[model samples]
Target: MHYNHYGREPVQLGVGLLNEPCASAAELGQRCAAAGLVLSRAPTTADLASVTEFLARWRAVVECVERTGRAALLNDLLAEYASAPRLTDHAGDGWHLHFRDPGVATDRQIAALVTVGTALHLTGLGMDRLGVCAADGCTRVYADTSRNGRQRFCSPACANRSAVRRHRAGRAAR
Candidate 1:
């Protein structure tokens, strides 16, 4: 089956980008290549700096969920991050929708996908599904793809750590 571009892949990529940042433009290019996005324009040192700056804005949107704002907040965030839609099928992979134009700077591309993809994710799933990990000292964002929609950690390790902490507390109380 054809993978859904607007689904988990984008979300995972967003988290991956947030979790591990590239120190330089070359590193950014390497990470993007590893993440499997074909760059339409050549990325430069400025592009990497811009991308890092953009990530800060994106993280604010994630933080908004701490207040448990409605989907409107997410929509507003998306609007601030994205531009007016201009469809392009640049790769000829098929006539698919692109919220931004091709051959733009890497920072612009990252912002576009992250903002729009995040909007689709929250709206398509639910607004409460995205947030930082609940485990102590862990501030990672989670996509929450579990069947019960109860995921609160960025990984199983955090989950286990939290669970073990809870178990120890319970035993001590008993």
Candidate 2:
């Protein structure tokens, strides 16, 4: 099951944002750039605030356990943040779909990008692909881009820790 960059990268960005929040617009801009997002300009304080609020909403979609509820939340986000999809050659990178209007504010652009990307991810993969880490005391979120789609922990370290804990508990019980 191959997933496009649109379906994968933005969800990763959302997870990154939720786990390690940005302290300033500059940091947010830097993070986006690091994630391969091209911003027209540096993010401002207002952009930072708006992105933070949007991430809070995006987190709900991630935390939703029911498939229907997750879809509904993502639909709400798509309606609120995204525009009609259109193909564009923006940046001369090649023709591709844009879920937002061109020349929007930086924050609005980020909102639209992340929202639409998440929608594509869930629909293309599975509704259960997004989740919080199952490791004890680890609250990180993850988008399961694995081929088998059975990811439960946010990382291999967390998975190992969880397995060790379970093994220890079983031994103790025995």
Candidate 3:
């Protein structure tokens, strides 16, 4: 039985979706394939637009977590994405669990994976592990899997930029 490493991969995929929304359904299929997920459907170009819009809503879940409301926001996302639990090992690997049913739509599948993965990550780590980038102009979402859990920026470059901006502001205040 392969234990799904459901924490980081889904979050990274979510980030990728947010960072570069698919311009066409084929692009969406390609992107998910690159992310190591096999799409059950061949999405049409219109589906790509829907996926982008759905991802925008998913980003809202990140945006709602402002040091507080983390639990509430995550709960909301989980509720939105997760379905009634069911047992499935139809691939004949081993008897494991599936939150949603098989043959679900592409967008729903992505959302379920992302929401459950995000919930698991935040709960397993800490409620404060997810947030927006601390960089001045970057609204990117960051899931802080750091040991210290004090991570703020989406990337080191953003962190450095934010630090420099803070230093400059301090100097100017003097």
Candidate 4:
């Protein structure tokens, strides 16, 4: 269940943003860098707005995965963002894939990356891999990369809280 950039980057960006919560253009640039994304230019206000849209679309993609009949909905969303793929060693890291043509708008670039990345993630991993946290009253998303493929909570703290709640509920019922 190793995650490529396609799977790993956006998921990390989503979770990292949810955890630390920042959106200024500088903040977005920093987040992308930390996620090992190679941005050709410094982020601008427009990029911030664009990535923000990516965040919203990403949330919907997560939700779509949980619905019974909406499984194919992600493909439609990805289709809207689709671009021709090109291989590049832009960062000199190694030859890798880019989903968009060179010199596209920053926002569209992010959309392409996220859409392609998520598609790869869902396909490379299992369709059941990404899911909502099982902890009661929590709605955070998680990419279930656990070896057993049984991940439920977004974090250990949530798992512990749910456990304590269940224990107390059982005692009350008893």
Candidate with the greatest lDDT versus the true structure: 2
- Pairwise lDDT winner, candidates 2 and 4: 2
* Model 3 stretches with alpha carbons more than 4 Å out: 1-5, 66-68, 92-94, 172-174
Candidate 1 is scored at a TM of 0.86
Tens-digit per-residue lDDT, 48-94, candidate 3: 76667767877877777564566676677678778887887666667
Number of residue pairs clashing in candidate 3, backbone atoms closer than 3 angstroms, sequence gap of 3 or more or interchain:
0
Candidate number with the higher TM-score (3 or 4) = 4
The CA lDDT at 21 in model 3 is: 65
Candidate 2, residue 1: the lDDT equals 37
Q: What does candidate 4's lDDT look like per residue over 1-174, in tens digits?
A: 322456678766665665455659898788878887667787899888777767776777676656443356677766677676778777666777777778877767666766777777777777777777888889887877788888888899999999999999999999
Worst 10 residues of 2 by lDDT: 1-10
Candidate 3 worst ten-residue window by lDDT? 65-74
Overall lDDT per candidate, in order of appearance: 0.72, 0.88, 0.75, 0.73
TM-scores of the models, in the order given:
0.86, 0.94, 0.84, 0.86
Regarding lDDT, does 3 or 4 come out ahead?
3
User: With candidate 2 superimposed using the best TM-score fit, by how many Å does residue 31's alpha carbon deviate from the native?
Assistant: 1.3
Tens digits of lDDT, candidate 1, 76-158: 75666566776555777765566766566677876677778777777777776777888999988777677787878899999
* All candidates in order of TM-score, best leading: 2, 4, 1, 3
